[model samples]
Target: MSAEHTASAPAGPLWRLALGRSLGRSRKFLWFLLINILPLYVASDLLVTSGALAKISGFLEPVMSLWGLPPEAAAVLLAGMLVNLYAATAVAAPLALSWQQVSVLGLILGIAHSLIMEAVVVRQLTRRYHALTLLRIVLGLGAGWLLALVLC
Candidate 1:
């Protein structure tokens, strides 16, 4: 283990190595982003505006309310446009959110959403992982809701 650690550890920043590797595969990443991410953003925006999200939100409201999240969160829940879990935070932030609600949104989204293509990218990066994705969603839900209860 120590040998493995020594082999992987470098004298410089990890980001430099990661950036080098990513830049080496920049074309692949760019194409991946183009084919996957752009389409998802468009679709998510359309679906939410087209009333699909409203229907879904209506269904989720009762359950989500338990975590102090309002139904509107469902819109952002489907989209991963936020880097810092921005979508959910944007919705919840304007509201009279308690720390619990904020934490719940933070935790839940910190784990779930953008499942369609991001999960594919994650799977590709981690070698065909479906279970981790599911686990993340479950953990996000549980952890967020739990945080809400505790904090709020």
Candidate 2:
């Protein structure tokens, strides 16, 4: 009876532990990063060059001012989303943005970036929209607002 119950039970610690070990292997992690990094970089460059970056900047610039950001901050924000943190930093650094603006950008990026891919990834993981996606946007904007208030 005990053996039957054990066999029928769902996978336990051993399965989880093995999975964790496999994931922890550096080769797998490196391969995963290698697979993704190039596409993200190329797409980020194209987005910036194709004027999408300018358009997004135009939209966000006004809203960002409330957070004490400059108009050009839109570039940084969009770059961060399209590329990653490093690319955004490169764009923003040349602007020599105020401390408040930097903080705000940090807050916004923390909540969401690479949004399209992320949405798909989230859907795959949860098998349902948990509505947290909306929360991410709100939190990003609110966080920027709060950070601006605190810093400025």
Candidate 3:
């Protein structure tokens, strides 16, 4: 109930940002954001805004460029892979990506989101977790490539 702890709904893409924000200003969402998203955003923000990621981004640019994304998208993609799509999205909102680029990112994450956790969940259900995980990643990238080629 305190002023400092209270956060307004987030702003950005309509459905993912606005609707989710409106529906998700609850305590649990706040806790999840603080715990799961904030640190990633903080580190990504520091690296991105401070220009510290330039060198790393240089190395990643080629890979991200395949998806018609900028090097900063690597952070967004990493956040999605290591954490969850929501976290990746939260991290990505400030990057000023175009609608088409966001769409490409969405296409990739939709197929391969939350690999670290989902892979474990998949492992619990099947013995082919590694293959499935690899397939998702490869398919995700391939899908992104196709989408980027089409969109751009």
Candidate 4:
């Protein structure tokens, strides 16, 4: 093709278009991550500093024992479900957990985290948010339980 024809081509290189679109998407994703995660981190820090986390952890001790995790692990799981993995990590970072416990928690949260935000997205796309949300929670719990049984 002549230089003029190529320069004015109706369809440019496919990869270039794709890369541009992906870069745009990544920028939006970074913004979304910052907006969602910053508040969670601050809240987690406040909860920890105020001793409220310890009280909540104590209350959740029995329930956490069922999963072979420490009471404080409940805060991590809650943060993951309610906010995101960053929030969960904030909660987990201060705790002392074995590799096995962290692994099990990872498996569980991988299956189910950011429920409210994700459910809204799912609802917009699939119109079955309730069912999907329930399924994710069940799967996460089941996986965690199974992992605990094997690892603990």
Q: Show the lowest summed lDDT stretch of 10 residues, model 3.
A: 3-12
Q: Summarize candidate 1's per-residue lDDT along 76-117 as a digit string, tens digits.
A: 555432333434444343345566665677678877766665
TM-score of each model, in listed order? 0.51, 0.56, 0.74, 0.69
- The local distance difference test score of each candidate is 0.65, 0.70, 0.83, 0.84
User: What lDDT score goes with residue 134 in model 4?
Assistant: 96
TM-score of 3: 0.74
Candidate 3 stretches greater than 4 Å from native:
1-26
**Where does candidate 2 have its weakest 10-residue lDDT segment?**
1-10
RMSD to true structure for each model, in Å: 7.2, 7.1, 10.5, 6.1
Residue-pair clashes per candidate? 0, 0, 0, 0
The TM-score that candidate 1 achieves is 0.51
State residue 14's C-alpha deviation in candidate 4, in Å. Answer: 8.5
Colliding pairs, model 2:
none
- In model 4, how large is the Cα lDDT of residue 52? 78
lDDT of 3 by residue, 53-116 (tens): 7666778888788888988888888888877898888778777789989999999999998997
Query: How many clashes in candidate 4?
Result: 0
lDDT tens readout by residue for model 4, 71-140: 8788899889998887787678656679989999999999999999999889888978899999999999
Best by TM-score: 3
